[model samples]
Target: MIKIPGEKLIWMYKTMLKIRHFEDKIHRLFLEGNMPGTIHLYQGQEAVAAGVCANLERSDVITSTHRPHGHALAKGVAIKSLMAELFARSTGCCGGKGGSMHVGDPDVGMIPAIAIVGGGIPVATGIALAFKFQKSKRVAVSFFGDGACNEGSFHESLNMGAIWNLPVIYVCENNLYGASTSIRVAVKIRDLAERASSYGIPGVVVDGNEAISVYQATSKAVERARGGQGPTLIECKTYRRGGHSRSDACNYRDKEEEKMWLTRDPVVILRERLTKDGILTPEDSKQMEKEIEEELTQAIHFAENSPWPKPEEALEQVWA
Candidate 1:
């Protein structure tokens, strides 16, 4: 276990809570028909983004998948701008161009998310190539789901990354199901990290629910990549407690399985550990939650009051 400082742990806790509350609010907004566009919520897998991003610098860039808000938040994107993006306001990070699935901010080093499955793999690889050519220590991270592993781009990008020793970290946020389909039905092998061996790169499997473990694994990977060693494939074993999309009811999931992952809720797990280890008291946790609620409230208010993009300006940001 990486011995994270008490203050850092609390900050991680806050990030996880922020992600949870953000998703919770989004879910309600979608249900109430106030929000436009569909969302792939990142409720239960907050720790993966929180932990991995904690190891990255602002100069480090990350390309996110369709389910990207957690990564955006963890990478230091402003909540107000993110909420505005979700609400389709012109004051958004992408000027209201990239909606829910495409939420991100260049100022924060998170590229506009690629909603297509496995699409960001090549883009991230290109970024690594850029970093290498510039001889910069900066790294690029690709955040994808289990489903992307099956894509051809995953293998090609990994092979190229390995051969060139690019400073790229491929993070697989395995939340059991790739949308509504389970991983078992997709890949015969159990451990997604094992695929790294074929590409001659280091692969690691970590408890995505445990922030410390994730931090340790990513820290090592980042160090190696910065040294011009190579890329790393970190598959974080996690589970999402909700449906894959806005309309999914998760009827395909087993009740017992859902219960198991719910018990392993990253936020709750970290909160318990923080309190039990004498790092935080119950009161302290509650205070943190209270603060996060205020932040969420303000973000939502900002989004609601933000301006919308003009109809004619839509084509301005688009490529001709």
Candidate 2:
């Protein structure tokens, strides 16, 4: 397992807590008619984003999915701006254009997240291509779900990355279900990482709920990419605790499956690990959660009071 420094571990905890609370608030806000747009909460898969991003530098890039709040927070997007963006205000991360699915700040090394399932896979490849042409060592990581593996872009991106040896890491957060469909019904292969070998790249499977394991796997992939070796595919075994989107009921998931995942809650596991390793006390963890909740409350107020973008503003950013 990769050993993170005290400061970094604390940062990870803070980020994860922020995502949890922020999404929880968004859910409430949407239900109460205070917020617009549909949301796909990142309630359970916090460790996957945190661990993968921990190995990335500020200049390094990453792509996110429709459920990208965790990646946005982990990649250093400011919470206030993210909340503002969700509110469709001018002060938002995208001037209110990107909204929930596209929340990102390139200034912080995160490109606006690609909402399309596997769209960002090739985009990440392009970013790595740019880095390679410039002889720079920045790595580009792509975050996609298990469903994206079946997309043509996934295959194309892997083939190109392997042939050119682009500095990219494909992270598949195999959360068991893609939208409302289970992976069992979608594909025959149980391990998405195995697809990596078809492109002549290394594929690793990691315990996505365990932050340490995810961090360690990502570290090696990042290093190999920096050393001009090539891309790698990391399939993180995890489960999404919520529906694919606010509209989803997840009627397809069995009660037993949900119960099994709840038992492996990422946040609970992290707290337990930190306490056991002597890196943090239970009290310290509680304090962190408290602080994050307070900050999120502030973000909610900021978004609430912020003015919406003027109607005429649509003509400004467009290139028509």
Listing every candidate in turn, what is its Cα RMSD in Å to the true structure after a full C-alpha superposition?
1.1, 1.1
Clashing pairs in 2: none
Q: What TM-score does candidate 2 get on C-alpha atoms?
A: 0.97
* Model 2 misplaced regions, further than 4 Å: none
Candidate 2 whole-model C-alpha lDDT, 0 to 1: 0.90
Best-performing candidate as measured by lDDT: 1
lDDT of 2 at 244: 85
TM-score, candidate 1, is 0.98
| lDDT by residue for model 1 (72-102), tens | 9999999999999989999988888788989
Model 1 C-alpha lDDT versus the unseen true structure: 0.92
Tens digits of lDDT, candidate 2, 211-285: 778989999999999999999999999998888888787889999989999899888888788788788897887
Clash pairs (backbone) in predicted model 1: none
